[model samples]
Target chain A: MKKIFKNQIALALAGILAGTSAVAGTLVINGDTSDPAPKAAFQAVIDGFEAENPDVDVVYNLFDHEGYKAAIRNFLSADAPDIAFWYAGNRMAPFVEAGLFAPIDDVWADQGLYSLMASSAPGMTMDGKKWGIPYTYYNWGVYYRQDIFEDLGISVPTNWDEFIAAGETLKANGITPITIGTKYLWTAGGVFDYLNLRTNGYDFHMALTSGDIAWTDDRVRATMANYQQLIDGGFFLENHAALSWQEALAPMANGEAAMYVMGNFAVAPLKELGLDDSSLGLFQFPAITPGVPMAEEAPTDTIHLTAGAKNVADAKRFLAYAARPDVQTAWNKALGQLPTNAGAGVTDDKFLNQAFSMLNNDAPGGVAQFYDRDTKAEMASIGMEAFQEFMVKPERLEKILERLEKARQKLY
Target chain B: MYSYWKNNQLKIAPWIFLAPGIFMFSLYVIFPIFQSINLSFYQWDGLGAKTYIGAENYIELLDDEYFIVSLKNNVIWLVLYLLAVPAGLFAALFLNQTVRGIRIYKSIFFFPFVISQVVVGLVFSWFYDPSNGLLNIILEFFGFDTIAILAEEDYVTYGIIAAGLWPQTAYCMILYLTGLNSVDPEQIEAGRIDNARGWRMLWYVILPQLKPATFIAVVVTIIGALRSFDLIDIMTGGGPWGSSRVLAYYMYEKAFSEYGFRMGYGAAIAVVLLLIMMVYIATILYRLYQDEKGS
Candidate 1:
């Protein structure tokens, strides 16, 4: 009887301890930190934070990459995490408009980190306030197989005529000049972004993606005409539509195809397939209108505070800590991408160096986030589908544009 | 109170027994249906305030070209999926013979149904892959140009339906196999004595015995056709320009995909699909009622 009474007393004491820890001030974070590198990068920052502030406990809710996209919409309405991982630009637009993400202007002011993230600020901005801080971003351009180009005696093309001629030469040698996989539909959008940026320039491309410019506009038609050149010339792989982006990489590796237009993130996987920097090459998509300054596609990933965030102070502190130059440099190094902070040091990697130059002030035209990132998600969807259809049948440009215009009218 | 309960037990007992089930059904199923109907009239982006705009979404859907294409594809799926019933019956008959290792044959025939739809979709996707896909490789061996079945917009929907039919037919075969086991042997013997054989014997004698199985197979096949989202999602994602989208997939794209959250619009699309499924459901129920009345 005495032992039973003692056990009951012990249970009550344990319950009290558990209750106290629950109220010990925790910053809940929902992140796609399941990937090893990202998890490590996040872990380092969290460790640093805890080392500094021992009073506060941190809770990290890690999810896999694709699952996080769907999970965010559902969780944001419930008891949302203090800090959430999300993309910048149009992907974050709807959430910002619905006020699911809290405005973190005060955090920026307190940390003075906004100046450090100035280049990436435009993507995270809505109206006047910054909704979040970006940590990592990567560039999108032409990823071509150099060995195939050498075999075909082709130099990197500069302008429209040279580009088409090079494609012809590659075709003569029995290689598809450009290989793409549009089964998932976003790869086609990357091609369209480059085409629009080169042909009509950045502002017009932005207008087109944002639904300000009609799909049937003369400029859009002109851009399609340029795109149609490659399509009609049979430059892309014949069975491109059947493959996903990863599956499409097989032909490039086997020398069946010469070139591909993809983001820098594709480099690691290509290297994993035993191809080096000499065998694989990165180049900007050639100019269509000779003097049109090249605006590059660099999509960014961001961290934000949810509106339902209970531990607001800790959330802001975490965002500020994440935006620190040393932290970002380490994170991006771990992540194998370019850090968003201007002062952050980048690792000595060739592709990332070129990617940095492509988006930095060295490039003539400023950064426009990729087609899908720059537009409303619905608008991007319509545009991507149209792009896929256009790639398949460029002759149906008029019809495709008309359909896209109608979707824009109804949706936006 | 106990004496009063005994006095009206006949009337009270049914309510007592049904109360929990009725309450649950109303909460989970019936309430959601009515809520969806209400949602169909509003414009909500799933996270924001809902604005009621009566029939606006439906009116927009009237002129939506994608809706029309999806409707057409759904019709294609519905028609093609019905072939499963006959195919299942044939497989059941083929495997009915008394032979060594017949159960193994039955299991092999039933294997596709045991696998999930997502895995089947993936397997079929590989089979239809243009460059090195099984189908194209065989065509190449025959000195013909390879066909990219999943890539062509005109053929994409049919390709997906063919994949869907594999598992649907397997499901029907299992049903028919069960029905065949329960068939009255005395009746079959009598039919044989009356000179009924081959097609006549099977149709007049065997098919009549499989009425219950046929009814279930037809109903399930129809439901499977309408519920064709997961395969399309795993395979094409309504792509090559949304050419292979069915109503369910289209509704999902509008409601939840990275495309955008147009919840009210999605609800409207769901309402249209519900109305279509309701017609078949109503016909089946009416037939069952008539059968009961005749009996």
Candidate 2:
């Protein structure tokens, strides 16, 4: 029996050694930052980091973007990985409030990320402390059909009147002026965010989304009025409500529609549908309240270090690595977005160039993360629905705004 | 231990056999259900501390427009979903005949049941797509403008129910088909002598024997209609502004979706839905008890 116990001890030691050798220093990452582009870009950085830091290994688990939202709350509070991928701004705020995320002040300071990601810093910060690293962000604008516009002799619109005129011109032609699908309902939000940002500017938009102001505010009604013009002009696709964002691209790709108010990420899918750079064009969502100073919708994607992270030191290293200008340059150049890192080099992709310039063009206010990112998910869900309903029936704007205001009262 | 087991094997073996299953059921099913009920009175965001807010969640639901909408949709689902049992009976009756290659027809008819509901939801979503879908093409061919089934608030729930019914009807048909095989030929022959044919024969002679199958069918269909989530989730996501939400989908949307995790409120919604299901289950079980007593 003593000999058997001795054998068990020997086997246990061997198992311990095996386990340690395999992954004692493995830094686990949990994310739902999804694909066609972002996942690969993230994986590349992970691979690069592991290769450079040969002492530590890495484990990556990617969940479906929507599934992760439900699961993250459980995981973050329990078996959290070293790092978790998520959105910045109000989306990160709730988690920050709950203290599920580690306050990574050291991460920002050690890497000098404060200066590097100055624009996105506020989005990830709550009560004067940083909770996550904002690695990358993309600008939202009107991606239009250049060839179709050339055919119609329409120049890119820069302000409300020109934008309306372009829409009228596109409508007068056989082509649909704008294509959108609000099936998942965030697509309408992009249009709403741009219009609100352009009309009321960032301060009011932020105030309104945060429930500091009511949806019944007249300035918001004015933004709705701008949206109504597009709806009444017969500008949008007839059955957009039935389609996903990808399905909405069918009309634009075939030149039946001329424009879409979407983000830079949509470029990859648009390219896949057989439209190249020469066929496409980029323009800022035209100014409405002409001097509102063109606040763009630029949602930053962030990575958080969990307070429950087993490998805090290694996760900090990864966060610092991700925040580095050289890493941001490589990651964003591959994904084709403007990096948050100030010193990061950018790609020569024309849309990316125009997007960078558009966001940086010394407009009075900088940028607002789009509706879903700017507000709580509950508010955003109701708001997106109201936006959809507004698109279909702008006459019900009063009722819709009243309903939204009621929800804001309840939720916030 | 070996000698003790050998001496009292019969006494210990049955419990030993049942232990794992009982352990798992209590852990996963029974425990979570009780926990959900307990959670209903407290405000807990799946991640953080739980704060007791006794009955606030239920009070909130009373005024919740989406909750009311979902409750109404559940009623519509239950009523419309009943049509599947009759439809399934008809399919089984129609295919009950002995024809050459009838096995292929059976497989084809049973195809929807074999496919996952997720796949069915996708197929139906594509089918209902206004511009690129076959349903709209057929509508256009008939010189009617297309109806965007999943997008229209009034029609969205109905569209999802139709997709759900496809698999549900197939499931019911298979159940009836098995029941039909167990149906006594002696009863059918006796009915023939009594001039009972067609509907009369099915009603009097066959269906009575198919009671066990009917019971299982109704139970499953009731459960299926209540949990008609995946189709609604995939096809519409309770949209055109939450018009398509059912109780299950609404609970999930509140608890899990990016809509925000109002766990207590979600649990309240779930408790109400569970109570509704429990009422039906109680009736069913009472009837089963009566039948067993009669036997």
Candidate 3:
């Protein structure tokens, strides 16, 4: 009777061990899936990862883009996932500084991701320690209706004067020159980043974000002046301040608006609205002044591991797989973005191909985006508000600049 | 011995019954308010250690142009939102008749309150759309140029307040409807005998009896106006360059939104907002206290 009881206890112990091992092999990811194609693409990668590691199970929790930011904060503060998608730059600095994120340096070195990622992944590092890996990036630029440009006999402009001329030409042809929604404020940032990059160049933008340059600096004033010019030229959608980015797309897709100065992500929405690849085209933002170093659109996104994560090994393995060339190609292709992986094959989609080529050949001296990710959040809030104020009442420029300077002083 | 034991048990029973509620109220409400006040005197990001910086945040607030704008806007919201009280009363009176399908009509009038603020914001945003929106379409039909209500700084705040009023008016209507149900029928008959009717009858008899509902309505509307975050967050995000920002939204932007975590500064903003709210809350509580004493 004693032998039989001992044997029964041993069998129960084996069952419990098996269950623990099975659970340990699974990885959970929290990400933003605001767009359908990107969500579907991410799911495909998850399936591929599971297929490659048959012992591993991948669980994904997806939220809307804007909703994900709030959800991520809660998740990080409480029960964090093993792996998560987050923005890089100063945005990640707080989390990294708090040791809420695991350093990815070991995995980064082992995979030699730097070789494939070019210089893009280095931006994910803080205090000389890498914390995240980038899968894809998109450039911010002018997306125009090619058909309208053709109808108006306007060529894509490479200079500021020509760009304004193009806007006038489109206007003459009964097309509103641009469609942008500033209700969220960051949409305005995309346009402003390009304007600043083209006018003041990259070093000044970096200096501006870093507090070395005041908001009222001549370089900053020039950037706002260029924006004022665009506004006065009747560029941008009617009632843009009332519209969201999706709402702004309607006019562009319907050919009522001729241009949209936005990121490559805008292609997905344009396609979703039933506009074909041929309907849209991309261009570098015109050089604001002759001989200024012209930068193309911003490139940023990161896949990070939480410091509090339990499944650190599994998370690293998942990130390594994500950085693989085929995974990068498949992911970017599905999302209509440029794969940071060097060997990732370019898509046949003309707009995407153009974006990839631009990212490869002519990307500006530096690779970071502006506002939210680049500057401290405290500064961004004030700076974005200042930008919005400048857009509405150009007369308030001096006050807005002074106020931003005050916010900068306090924040820094 | 038996009388002493029974008296002690009765005294302790009331305390026991009150303990759980009082504990919860202090834990969730009272404690957080004190914590926020303490935090207001420090400088800390959401993460990292906090450092004491007495009165610097407050002094900065004095010079904060955006804060000044937000304060002015909040005052406007408070003043404008009070219009819901009388408007709701009138709506309740119109729908209180014992006509056929009156129940359906009442429910229809409360529909705006049933929907979430996000949906309300979306609906109102579409209504104010310059090109394809219903408002502009109607204006164009009458040969008027489309007006972008949300884009112009002069009109943006009014546009947001109009959206806020839709649900606020509905809330007021429901409160008045309940008040009307409990009105003394004998008193109404007495007023009718004296040939009192319309505005005169309402002012003299019915309105005075509905004071409790009006008081509750005012309290709630003031709180709602002060806490108006969702509509502005969704519709305009206090844009056309911060023209529509209220204190709550501005506080959130300063503390949480993409800006750096100025948790200490945010707490400072919260403290100021709380002080402003305390004035209204104290007045309401004082009146309630007087009524209890008189009774």
Candidate 2 lands at a TM-score of: 0.92
Report the error of model 3 at residue A156, Å: 1.8
* Model 3 regions more than 4 Å off: A1-28, A55-64, A77-80, B1-4
The top-ranked prediction according to lDDT is 1
lDDT of 2 by residue, A35-64 (tens): 557788888999999989998888887765
Checking candidate 2 for backbone clashes, the offending pairs are: none
Best prediction by TM-score: 1
**TM-score, chain B, each candidate:** 0.97, 0.92, 0.95
RMSD in angstroms between candidate 1 and the native structure over all alpha carbons: 7.0
Cα lDDT tens digits, model 3, A199-271, are 8887788788878888878888888899999887777766677677878899999889988888877887798
Better of 1 and 2 by lDDT: 1
In model 1, which residue pairs have backbone atoms overlapping below 3 Å? none
Candidate 3 chain A, run of 10 with poorest lDDT: A1-10
* RMSD after CA superposition, every candidate: 7.0, 7.1, 8.0
Count clashing pairs, candidate 2.
0
All candidates in order of lDDT, best leading: 1, 2, 3
DockQ pick, better of 1 and 3: 1
Model 2 chain B weakest 10-residue run by lDDT: B252-261
Q: How accurate is candidate 2 locally (lDDT)?
A: 0.85
Better of 1 and 3 by TM-score: 1
